[model samples]
Every structure is written in C-alpha cells, then in structure tokens.
Target chain A: MVSVAFKKNLKEKYGIEFNNEDLLERAFTHSSYANEHHGKHNYEKLEFLGDAVLELAISDYLYRNYPKLNEGQLTRMRSNIVRTEGFSEFAKEVGFQNEIYLGNGEEKSGARNRKTLLEDVFEAFNGALFLDQGMSAVQRFLKQTVYPLIDEGDFDASRDYKTELQEKLQINGAIDIKYEVIAEDESVPTFTVQLLVNNQKVATGTGRNKKAAEQQAAAKALKK
Target chain B: MVSVAFKKNLKEKYGIEFNNEDLLERAFTHSSYANEHHGKHNYEKLEFLGDAVLELAISDYLYRNYPKLNEGQLTRMRSNIVRTEGFSEFAKEVGFQNEIYLGNGEEKSGARNRKTLLEDVFEAFNGALFLDQGMSAVQRFLKQTVYPLIDEGDFDASRDYKTELQEKLQINGAIDIKYEVIAEDESVPTFTVQLLVNNQKVATGTGRNKKAAEQQAAAKALKK
Candidate 1:
C-alpha cells in the first residue's frame, strides 16, 4: 500500500501533484512485483510512454533554447542528459529509491538500489505522471530537473573531437577533410560516417545521424 | 518561395492546414537548400523535434492499441512503422518529392528523389507540424498514414526466433538455457545479452534495452 506521506513528499519534491493516485502507484510498481502478484500490469508500458514523452520534452527544450547548436549537437546534448547514467542520477535526486515497490525476490536482492532499475522507474514515473497529468506535467518535471543541468553547461562541456582532430592534422599542412556516409545496415539502421583525410580513410564511426558518426570517427582517429 | 497551392494541397491531401506558413516552408527546406539560401534554417532542427514527436505519437498509439504486446514488441513495431523505409513510403504517398526544396546541386543530382531524403523531410514536416499545430495534428497525420499500416498487420508478421531456437535445440532433449549480461560498455552502453544453451554460451546481441538484446541474441542463436 502506498502511503499518503509518500504522495505528499512527491508533490513537495517535484511539484507533481497527481490526480490519479492509482497511476502514481502503478509507476512505482516494478515488473517483478507485478508478475509475483498474479499478472498485474507493470511499469514497462508506462516506461515506454514516459520514454517518448521525456524525449519530446527534452528535444523541444533543446530546440527552443539552443539556437546555435546544430541538430547533431542538440541530439548529443539530449543523449547526454537522458542516457542511463544521467537518468539514474536524476532518479536518485528525485528520491525514488525508498518509494519503488519491488517484488519479494527483487527486494531481497536489493533491486530497488539497482542503477538500471532506478533509471527505468524514473522513465516509468514520468510516463505514469504523463498519463495522469499530461505532457505539461512531465515538462514541468523536466524543467525542474533536466533544464537546470543543461543551463549549467553540465552536458555542454564535452570535448569537440572533430575540432581537435582537425587542429591536430592542420600542422601537417592543409589537407582535404571529408566525412562520407557509408551504406547503412538495416539492423538498428544508423548512418556510419568515415573520416577521409587527403582521400585516405582513417577511421569510421556510427551514429543515429551523420555529425555524431563523424565526431566518433574523429575521436577514433585522434586515439590512433 | 512556398506556393499557396502547396499549402492548399497539403490541406486537401493530408488534412494538415498550417497556422504558421513559415514553419511549413521551413519543413520542406533541406540542409543543402538552407546552405545555398544563406542563413535560412533547415529542416534538421524540426526533423529532430518532429522525430521525437512522431515517435511519441506512434509509441502512444502502439501502447494503447496493442495492450498484450510487451514493450519489446511495441518498440519493434514502432520502429518498423516510423523507420526510414516507412517514413519515405508515407512521404511519397503525400507527394513530397515534387514539393521538397533541394539545393541547386541536389536538385540537379536528383537528391530530392533520394530514399533517405524523402524519409528525412517527412520527419521534419512532422516536427514543424508539431510545433505549429501540436501533437493532435501530428496524431491525425499518423492516423491517416501510420496507424492504418499498423492496423493492416504490416509490422505484425515477423519471424519468431525464440520459439524456433527452442524447438531446434529441443530435438536433442532437455537443454539448459541462460542469457547473461556480460559487460556493459558505457560508450554505446546498451545491454549486451548473451544466450547460453546447456550452460554453453552461443551468441551475444546488444540493444538499448534488455528484451531487445535478448531478441537479437535469440535471432542470432536461431541462425546458428
């Protein structure tokens, strides 16, 4: 049973006052908990929904706020903010560890303290929060959590590998730097960009987009 | 210059009447097109936003319509529906090839007709549409295009690997099966699940999530 104090604490911490207490409860209910309790619906579905909502909110914020950053930079920044480590960190800050409802086995194994599971439930909580309160609620949650981090240049201070690599190679006199897109494979289907220096291919990297691949390739080249 | 005729046609064809005509213009403007035009924003930013919007819409639909399907199946189905092939197909149906603005070079080289470009423009259009008209309008576009395809079992029929792999190994009588998470590399940082049969590891596969990794592992094992 979810305590009223927990709900009140959530409201105080995140300003996320849920109208649907059941949805809020469902968000914290892990799959193992659901399975052990005879096929009850778990947070997986909510996680799916919340994952999308979280992405859109974050993407929208990045697009609106970061005018100078190209799509690739925006994407990488979003990835940095929303990826597993970042999410788990945010989830921990949101104080979900004590609130997550785990099955007996998972509880015995200390699954509530698990990093991956912690990240997952935040996404699920956002999803459940989205269902109960809608996108604005999720947006509000992000505004409080993700936006501040972005504003503080937390994800922005990462190395510009392509710039670094280009500068390094320029000492050998000016050479042609071309990044070409290799034919994409259908499995996960990301674009692979190969870095060609003076018409000789140095390294290749894959990403969901071209610039990201080029950056990775540049990083690989620098390493070499 | 975006013609009024194109806007009228979009209204008639896809039922997308834009409140912001500039956004409509921006949506069709490719990166190459923007580069040639001098400081004009391209569709990439919108594509980023729209990509997330399109995903959330498709994800929301899949979640609601297919309750029995787990998050893994829901994700695969969404991927199939919103992937490059599907986006290009839907974009072609909406007559974007004729309307898309390519740069002089791209126009001469037939980049407008390119499969990947076609896919990209639709995603950008959705992003622009999402910004102007919001999620409901985007959902309407998907309903006319993506939802129908989903209903027709277009993405439903796929090879069931786990079942096939199980049956194949069962011919030898009782076999031990285990899928283990070997090591998670934070670079791409997806769960890498390794399949084991009779305590011997067979194949490993990676995914953004566990179930997807397991599916890929199963698929690999089936092939073996």
Candidate 2:
C-alpha cells in the first residue's frame, strides 16, 4: 500500500494527485517484486512509456526554447538532462527512493537506494503522469523540475569539448581548431569527423550517428 | 512551395490539412537548397522535432498495444519502424522524393532521391505536423501510415532468433538449449550469456545491455 505521506508529498510537490492510485503504485513497482508476487505487475512497461514521454517533453522543450541550437546541440542537451545521473538526482529530489516497491531479495540488497531504480522511477512516474492526466500534466511536471535545471545551465557540462580543448590548448597560447566531416558513409550512415588545429588535422573520430561524431572528434583532439 | 495536388493527396490520405503551408514547404527544403537560396532555411530543425514526435507516438502505441512485451522488445520494434530503411520506404510511398527541394549541384548529384534525404523528409514532415497542429495531429498522421505497418507485423524480422535457431537446429534433430547469465560485469553493465546445448555449454556471448546478450549468445551457438 502506498503511503498517505507519499500522496501528500505528491500533492505538495507536483500540485496534482492521481485519480487512479493503482497506476501510481505500478509506476514504482520494480520487476523483481512483480516476479516474486503472484499477480503483481512491474514498472517495466511504464518505464518504456515514461522513457518516450520524457523524450518528447525534453525534445519539445529544446525545440521551442533553443531556437538557435542545432539538432546535435539539442540532442546533447537532452542526453545530459535525461541521463542516468540526472534522472537519479531528480528521483532523489522528488522522494522516489523511499516510494519504490521491491522484492524481498531486492530490498535486502538495498534496491530502494540503487541509482538505476531511482532513475527508472523518475521515468515510470513520467509514464504514470502522462497516463493519469495527459501530455499537459507531463509538461507541467517537467516545467517544475526539468525547466529549472535547464535555466541553471546544469546540463551544459557534457559536450563542451570545444571549450575544454580550447582551454587546454590556450595554456600553450592562442590556438585555432575546427571540426570537419571527413566522410559520410552511406551504408552505415556514419559521420567521420576530423579535428584540425593550426590548419593541420590532429585527431579523427567516427560516430554511427550525427550528434556523437563532433563530440567524439573534439574529445579525441583534447586527448592529443 | 507545397503543391495543391500534394495538399489534396494529404487530405485524401491523412484526412487532415495544414494551416501553415510554410511549415510543409520547410519540411521538404534541404540544406543545400537553403545554402544556395540565401534566404531560405533548411528542414534540419523540423527533422529533429519530427524524430522526437515520431518516437513519442511509436512508444505510446507500443506501450498500449504490446502489453506482454518487455522494454527491449518494444525498443527493437520502434527501431525497426523508424530506422533509415523504414523511413525511406514511408517517404517514397508519400511521394516525398519528388517533393524534395535541392540545390542545382545537389539535384545534379541525385541528392533529392537519396535514401538519407528521403528519411529526413519523413521525420521533417512529422515535425511540421506536430508544430502546425499538436501531439494529437502527429498521432493521427502516424496512425494513417505507421500504425497499419505495426498491425501488419512487418517489424517481426529483426528479433526472429528463436525461429531461425530452431530451424537450423531442427535439421540436426532434438536440441536442448539453456541460456544462463554467468557473469554481469557492471563496469560495462554487460550480461555475459552462456548457451548450453544438450546440457553442455557450447558458447558464450556478452552484450553491453540485456536485449542483445541472448541474441548474441544464440548467434554464436549457431556459428558453432
């Protein structure tokens, strides 16, 4: 049974309570718990739904707000915000660690405090929120938590390779560096990125997709 | 400009029409074309948005319909539906190839009919629909095309390992196989799968995550 304290906390924090409390319960149910119980279902499906919901919210937010940022920038931003560390932090902030349902063995392993479980609860809650109310509710929940993080520029830590590389190279004095897509292979559709410093190519990196290629190139350049 | 016949075709097919013809036009506008035009913008942003919109729609649909399928299965199903080949096929069916705007140089190079361009158009169009209408409109648009494809079970091709392996083994007559997780190393968080045939361990495979481990093990077993 979900606690009155948890429900009260939700009302205080997210400013909405669920009409179907069972959905809320299921959102916190770990797979191990469901496997042990005869009829209980886990949060895996909800996590799947939540993952998609979170993706939509973050993508939409990035799309509308950061008009000047390219797709790669937006993608990197979303990744920073929704990654396991970020999600786990959000879960902890919202008191999800205590609310998570676990099996006897899992609980003995201190599953409630596990980062993966916490991260998952954050997503499952998103799925539950989307189901309970709609897209608008999910948006509202994100606005309160995620939007603030964006405002603080907390998610900017990753994919700042250019800055890091520049800073590193600046110790040796002014440096000129550029990244160019050296190849775009059609079969796998990967982009091979080459980093050039002082008009000479120094490092090369390849990503199967667009976003990672530039970062990978920069990261390799920094290492050199 | 988006053609009147194209608009009529969309109306006949999707039963929906866009109020913002500009968005529709932008969806077909390629980067090379925009670079030459001096004033026109490309469809990259729209494609990014569309990718998210498409992800959300597909994920929600899978979550609702595939009640018994786990997260990995849902992920594979989504990947098959939205991958380059699938998106290109969808774009061709909707006549997006002919509609694509390209620079003189690009057109001469046959960029307009390229599979990557076709795939981009499919995503950009989705983004346009979402921006012009909303989430509901995007869902409606996908329901007309992608929903039917899912219903047809066309995505069953990717994870048919059981069928394939069984077929291969049946020729040899009566095979007993058991897959066990011998080790789960957290540094990579990989599941090491050991495949036992007739109670004798035949092969082992490792994957960075859960979904691919069993399949990798199966594939290795078959190779043996």
Candidate 3:
C-alpha cells in the first residue's frame, strides 16, 4: 500500500500535483520492490519511456537554445547533461532516494544510493510524468530543472578526436588531412578507416561503423 | 554545386521551405559527396542527431497512443517503422532519391536506391528539419507524416512476439510464464535471460541489457 503522506511530500517537492497518484507511485516502485510485492508495481516500462522523453526534451532544449553550435558540440553537451552521473546527482537533489520504494533486500543493500538505480528511477519518473501529462509538461519540467546545467559558452571546451588530429597535423606542417574508409568487412560489418596527412598514411583504425572508425583513426593520428 | 531546380522540387514535396538553405543542402549531401566537395557539406552529424530525434518522436507517439501496449511492443513498432525497408520505401515516396547529392562513384553504384543509403538520408533529412525549423517543427512534421503510417492499423495488424508467446503457452496449458535474467556478464556488460513455462526453461537468450535479453527470450519462445 502506498502512503498518502509520501504522495503529498512528492507533490510539494516537485511543486506539481498529480491527478493520477498511481503514476507517481509507479515511478517510485523499483523492480526489486515489484518482485517482492508479487508484480503489483514496477518502474521498468516507465523508465524505458522516460529515457526516450528525457532525450527528446534535452535535444529540443539544446537545439532551441544553441542556434550557432555544431552537431558535435551539441552531442557532447547533451551527453554530459544526460549521463548517469548527472541524473543520479539530480535524483539525490530532488530527494528521490527518500521517495523510492525498495524491497527489503534492496533496502539492506542501499540500492537507493546506487547511481545506475537512481538514474533509471529518475528516467522512469520522467516517463511517468510524460504519460500522465504530455510532452508539454515534460518539456516544461526539463526546462525548469535540467536545461540550466548546460553552458553554451563551453561548447568547444573539450578536444574531440577530429579537432585534435587536425591541430596536431597543422603543428607538424601537414597541410591537408583526409579520412577514408579503406576496407569494410561484411561479416562483422566493421569499417577500417585510414587517416592521411599531406597524402601520407598517418594512422588507421577499425570500428563498427565509418564514423566510429574515422574517430578512432583521428585519435590514433593525434597520439602519433 | 547543388542544383537550384532539385532544391525547389524537394521544398514542394516536403511541404516546408527551408529557413537555412545550408541545412537542406547538407541533408542531401552524402559523406561521399562531402569527400569530393572538400568536406564543406555532409550528412553524418545530422544523421546522428536525427537517429536520436526519430527514436524519441516514435517512442513518444507510441506511448501516448497505446495505453495497454508494453515497452517491447513499442520498441518493435518503432524498429519496424524506422528500419531500412520502411525508410527506403518512405524515401522513394518522398523523392529523396532525386534530391540526394552523391559522388560520381556513389551515383554509378546506384547508392541512392540502396536501402541503407535511403535510411541514412531520410534520418539526415530529419536532422536538417530539426536544425532549420527547431524541435517544434520537426515534432509536428514527424507527428503528421510518420505517426499516421504507424497508427493507420497496419502496424497493429501484425502479431507481436510477446502475444504469440502468451498464446502458445496458453494453448499448451502452461499456466505460469516468467522471464528471468539468470546471469550478468561484466566483460561484455550483457544479461542472459531465460523464458520459463510451467517452471521449465523454454528458451534462453542474451543481449546487451536485461530488457533486450528478455525480448530475445520472448522471441525465441514464440519461435518454439
């Protein structure tokens, strides 16, 4: 049985009242708890949906706010903002640990403090919010909570492999840099990329796809 | 240089004129073309973002429209709608083959007609839409175009793996069915799941995550 006081506390903390209290309850209910409660409640499905909703909300915020930023910069920023560490921290800040329902085993193991568990629960909560309300509500919640963490000014702060390779080659007086997919294996569907600096093969790398292989080759070139 | 007539035709077909011509140009410009055109234009970055955006849009639509549908069903529906065959057909219908910019080699090889290429370009176009008009516009376009195709009773017409598995088990007089993640491998970060019918293992499968493993198990159970 879910506590009415718990529901009230969550509403107060989030500053939003839920019409379907069961949605909120479902968000907080962990798989361990669901197992213990004989499959009465679980956050698994909600977490799946929430993960998608969270990605969209974050992507939308980034796209709208940063008009001048390139795809690579936006991707890195998005990754930083949405990673498990960030979600876990946000969950702790929002007092999700106290609200989460865990089985006796999970409680004894301190599962609420686990970063992956908390992150999954946070995603599940977002999913529940989207299901209960709509995209608009989820977007508003993301804008209010998560959007502020990303700094547009720090877009080019990190040295990506491609950038690093270009810089390294330029310093060494290499005029032109080129990446070519040299070979593709059909069995594993792996692509082999060759990095050329001034018509000379500088490095080679393989990956599951061309972009990944190119990144790897660039990383290798940077190292050399 | 991209042909002006080609661009105009695309504008008429897509029903949205581009705010940034560069975005549209980039959407049509393949990596092969970019390689030939001094790397000034390409669809790789757009394709990455588009993939995420497409997944989110489809997931959101499925969650909202199907209240009784589970995560696996939603995922399968998304995959079916976004797969190479689906995208290839959609791309052909939308005149993407005519609009795409390809290198001489790619053009000679009929890359525009290739299923993988069509899928990539379609996703790249999605990225272009997101960049040019913002998330709202992209969301609207996705809801209008892609959502209808999924919701038009054709997608729901097919029997799903879970449903088949359930029906089969019921017919076989197996009163109890359960999916359990029996093992977790830290090396590959994979989970091994087993489908149990009447307290006996009916099928076993492994995947990168527990949900995937469970789905695989269900799929195997259906095959059995």
Which scores greater on lDDT, model 1 or model 3? 1
What TM-score against the true fold does each predicted structure earn? 0.71, 0.73, 0.58
DockQ of predicted model 3? 0.26
Candidate 1: where is the Cα deviation over 4 Å?
A157-224, B157-224
lDDT (Cα, tens digit) per residue for candidate 1, span A1-224: 56777777778877878798788788888988888888567888889888898899899999999999999998898887777266765676667777888889999998988889988888999888878887888888888776876775656626768888899999989989999998575334366888999999999998644545777898899999
Instruction: Give the per-residue lDDT of model 2 (tens digit) for B1-224.
Output: 87788888899988879899899999999998999998898999899889888988998998888877888888888877777266775676677887888999999998877878888899999999999999899888778766876775656445556457778877888888778888887443457888887889887877643334666777777776
Kindly list the per-residue Cα lDDT of model 1 for residues B13-121, writing each as its tens digit.
7787878888988888988888888877788998889889988998889888999898888878777667636677677667777788888998999898788998888
DockQ of 2: 0.50
Clashing pairs in 2: none
Give the candidates in order of TM-score, highest first: 2, 1, 3
Q: Count the backbone clashes (under 3 Å) in each candidate.
A: 2, 0, 0
* Per-residue accuracy of model 3 over A74-148 as CA lDDT, tens digit each: 787777567636676567656677888898998998887998998988899899888788777787766555654
In terms of docking quality, how is candidate 2 classified?
medium
Model 2, span A179-213: residue lDDT tens: 88889873444678888889898888776433356
Pick the TM-score winner: 2
lDDT of 3 by residue, B37-139 (tens): 8856678778767877787777777877886777677667767666625665556656677778888999998887897988888888887887787666776
Which pairs of residues collide in candidate 3?
A: none
